[model samples]
Target: MNIPKQRIKISLAMVMPALVSLSILMTMSIMFYIQYKNEKRSLYNNTMSLNLSSAQKMAVTIEALFSGMRQSLRASANNPAIEASAASDQKELQVIFDLMLQSSPYFNSVFWADQAGTIRVVSPVGNNLNQDRLKTEGTTEALQERKSYISAPYRTPAGRWIVLASEPIFDSSGKYHGMIGGTIYLEENNILHRIFGSGAGNGKESYSYIVDSGGRLLYHLDKSRVGENVSSNVVVKRLMGGESGMQRVMNTHGDDYLAGYASVTMNGWGIVMQTSVSSILADVDRNLEEQLRSMLFPIVLMLVIAAYTAARIAAPFTRLYKLTKSVAAGQTVSSEEFRPHWNREADQLNHIMRAAAESLAKQTLSLQQEAVTDPLTGLSNRRELERCLDSWEALRDPYAVLMLDIDHFKSVNDTYGHQTGDQVLKLVAAVMSDDVPKGAVCSRFGGEEFVILLRKHSMDEAYRLAERIRNAILISKTPYLLPLTVSIGVSLYPEHGRSREDVFQAADMALYRAKNEGRNRTIAGVKSA
Candidate 1:
């Protein structure tokens, strides 16, 4: 080996071409393999995106269909004639239910049940009237949950598969009073058939179906399989357990499938769209083969160019490594700095990094906003209020705190339900926010309680502002309910206390006084400066 040194020293020009040529060929092969992988990855991502979108659309349609049935029952349950549960109004209730059934072709039957679980009044005057439904899980669950419900699909004695949507009725005092519900016959319902059928088009290989949270088949193209138990199927098990995503799993017949599934919002039912694995991969394989052929000539040319300029190649690579390091270290890099003349891969990577940075920035901003904002009322949450208060206190700025609450808010929730109660809060928050000065802040402190800060306002000005807010609430009319009223308590900064806690306590005491004094009025804290 030591004696070979003199022989290995060939002319520099002759050895350089051969050494560079081999190096160029290896580099070109590695780069081509990377591009090949990226193409395949892109194809997979696009296919999965299409599948997920289709699954979401099917899930939304199914959810809306069931929601319509439940909403109809809920609306009818609120009717005074049906709520009375009186024998005298039985004829009127029957007529109302009959009208409901006539309005919606999706419902096979509509009925009202008594507290004893006996179907007292039914539309179309069917033989199922006067039947006891307490033994059934659907009716019993409705009574127990005291809310709206959708049952798993079941086959009736009449050989019809139906899902029940029920709303629990409550008396004036918020006591449970039977339920109002309707039967959604899946066997012949055009709506369900359209939903499952439309997702697949006219394709025989791809299909869509639905199953409940209990893994019971609610809908299927195979008519004989409706109401069958699918709990043993791995995909059904994941869906019933509330997992929503795409998967490649073996079907019952030992065949692989690419399946995308989502949970229906109303009933926790799973909607699945399935296609054969072979069909999905067929196009991908063909496209990949074509890509390899098209890339053959380009790769060969790149190798020649690399052999001629091998000495300069390391410079561009070093520059690219530095650019990538800057990005990884969270520094912004411009795309124009890296021209494709030097390296096309560098240009592509620059664009990708720029897009990623921009997306991350947007997501960070959105998360920050969500953190400080109340979801329901669109006002500052308690955390935001605390932070703003601390900032003001640190600056020693003068401000007024107005503590406000909706009168009889619990009664509203018990009567009209929680959804309406949320609406009431939003209305109050909106009114206060609009009427307040530009620098002022309105926040939801907690349930049924709101706080307002009026900066640079004197005690009398603060009291006047509180009075205006109270008057606005008194005149505000809810869409479905009577006018709402609010009581307010005003506390002045530095006059009541130098700290946030003291001012809050003073405002709380004053709010209690306002509540005691015939309600719907504003009371100011005692001046203590």
Candidate 2:
């Protein structure tokens, strides 16, 4: 019986190009790494500068808005028809209130309240807290002080949070009768949107928010947080102190951000704009990618030239060595091949070629290893994951995609510091490696996220595996006595999705769903029988 020999061969020329390429690659990577880091630092500085400018722009816009609001309130207050008409004269006041609403579309409501804080006529009705004294922040001051005032954020009896801009109503004789108040509803009427709706940040991850002097959020891109206190926020704290500038801060939710803040002059309210640090670094990665693409032609050209030149130089020697020689990844050329052949020039050439071949072979393996493995986690990297997925897809093999994220992992970093956070990541990686069977590809899928591709797994099997990992992590001890939990999303191949992108996306959506559904459990995506 005849057995077929392996077709692929590793030769002297084949090894030389990789050797040259590896050396060049090392030099370029180091230089590029330095440049990459510098670029990141530069990007951060630029983002902060832009954020500060955006915050200032929004603050100035709001100030101008208040100036206009004040003018409208003053005009309404001093108007003969409205000012002289008794607060009890609802018919006369209604005409003027309707006119004020048209001119000040930015205001949510308009009202006439007498000196006793009893609201008389309210425009945009249903907001009638008429029977009660004016308890909202700024209205009472304007009535008692007999001066124009802008209130801090306060909740209306209608349960709406707003800023009340009010002017005292006094006749030409300077006798105070009542106050005119215009309401800027925090969440509705698009007033905040009209001022900050264009948004200060570049993308969805970036947003602008407003906080009162007391730290209550008057406006935020997330309406749910509008009334929540953000005084503990670094940017908000600075804004409260009348300090305006840009800085890198970690928010209350343990996310790092580049933020800029300014206090609105009218009421000492702080306006802040912020973007995520990770988002800015993504830009840096794109720059690096562009840089790599530009370098690609030169790299390929060098490899081609090196391979041709090395082959041309070794032509005669190759004829002699071709039949008897081959070098596998870990195997080396016998030292006997390096012994003196007794012809000085021929001996030296042969010796050097053999040694060079061995060196390059080792280097080729080293570069391949480094390319596919994650340095920190020692697991397969993203490139490897993609490569394996492609191979499996081509073969029409079954697999399960599990995306796992460490819950509140940011808090681990914030509380114990980044070094400790790194330790937690490693430990989690270790747990994943130990729990998941061998040959399953587990990767640190950026930040606190991990991805596992389980070969030949059904949807149920994949979910069970995810639960095992989650339970192990929850019960596992941390480097600093911190308890950790994981959210896992499982999706199966061919059933959930036939393509790589589709499958990963299914798993990712499930992963986020698990997180959204309050974490520490597995959610199966795209279920199939």
Candidate 3:
């Protein structure tokens, strides 16, 4: 099998350009990929740092609220009214608790417990009483320690989970008399709602909650998590031991979350704030997607431009190749040949193409001129006269038509030979051509006949130009060595006829009148009635 040499040669020539373009394109793509990866990594790190800072801020807010509550309760416990009420009538104690509750939204309930483990509860309501119930064992032990204590969360008889704040009361003798305590229903208070409600996640996906030393959820924004055990999580276990910790974990519900925990000072409870990873990193994800699109946009645009450049650079060569192939295949090549290639070599090729086209056009025009001219008079043939008249009439301007005949032209052609007749016609054409205005067009209508189109000129101007040509002709001596004169007939536009045929008839009638009235004279046609 013989392989084609032309195919091999073309393939080799194209290889270098393609390889250079491909190498540059691949390098750019790799660089862009690396840049995109680095951008995504940086965004991820920034998102993580921002989420951590937000969690820390929430922790600080919760700590501040709890600290304020502790201080307020401590102040209330030291009040003389509160101290006296705890020792005397329970009704008076209820009044003091009611007053404290009214003073702040933070207080849930206040109660007094005596050293005998008997408890009198002043519910959140001002007059509610549940007297002499069993004192919470945790509260009893906590008061015996002779210092203020915040007990772990526990469920009350009403099935509500609450946190207990207890402070031991002492007399002037320095003896512990009993304890003054406040019960806070953490879920009912607004602290959790404020923190978690304003937190950065969709409703079901994020939460803030308080946990006890037992790793049980004491209060959550969702309310349903109260008393739920969370000790299984490693972060929860560390937090339960009163150490602050943070980690990413899957909760019992199988949702990924970023959990931040911090223990309350001198209180056995910890606050754990959890935010879903999806919520915390949502902005980063959206930004990454936009960045990726931005990066890809340039790549796509570059590829399009490269493709266009390649196509543009190759188009001229492709056309040249096709033309060469046509010649090689023995196709007929005319004088009007295919256009030359447009490239670095275009200047030389364009000069050659222009010269060839001009030479061919001159040859074609000479042949056409010979066919349209009368040999005897060197004037337009009858066919060319009609074509010129038709073209002039189609124009949208007012003009005059004239017809001239040599007086005794046939007699001169008969006696002095056709050579003198030709001379007379040439002399007439010269006189008419020279005397016409700059923009007027004169054409040989036929042998012994001519037409003039004066653009935008008045009928008077046209007649004046015609009279000048007639006078010039009347005084002229032809090179034929014989004196000659022409009879002229003139007709004005619209006054003679609205159409070219009518104008021609009017001019002819004036010419007939000149011949009838006598020879060697000019005559103007009267307007048609």
- Best candidate according to lDDT: 2
Q: What's model 3's lDDT at 36?
A: 61
Q: How does each model score on TM-score?
A: 0.44, 0.56, 0.49
> In candidate 2, what are the lDDT values of residues 21-125, reduced to their tens digit?
765676688779989899989888888898889888888988888888889888888788775565457777777787778878668889888888997778876
Error in Å for residue 59 of model 3: 4.0
Model 1, 188-220: lDDT tens digits are 655677556765633435676788889888778
Q: Lowest summed-lDDT stretch of 10 residues in model 1?
A: 11-20
Task: Arrange candidates by lDDT, descending.
Answer: 2, 1, 3
After the best TM-score superposition of candidate 3, give how far the Cα of residue 64 lies from its true spot, in angstroms: 3.8
Best by TM-score: 2
Global lDDT of each model?
0.75, 0.80, 0.66
Report lDDT (Cα) of residue 295, candidate 3: 71
Q: What is the lDDT of residue 73 in candidate 2?
A: 85
TM-score computed on alpha carbons, candidate 3 = 0.49
User: Per the 3 Å backbone cut-off, how many clashing residue pairs does candidate 3 have?
Assistant: 0
Better of 1 and 2 by TM-score: 2
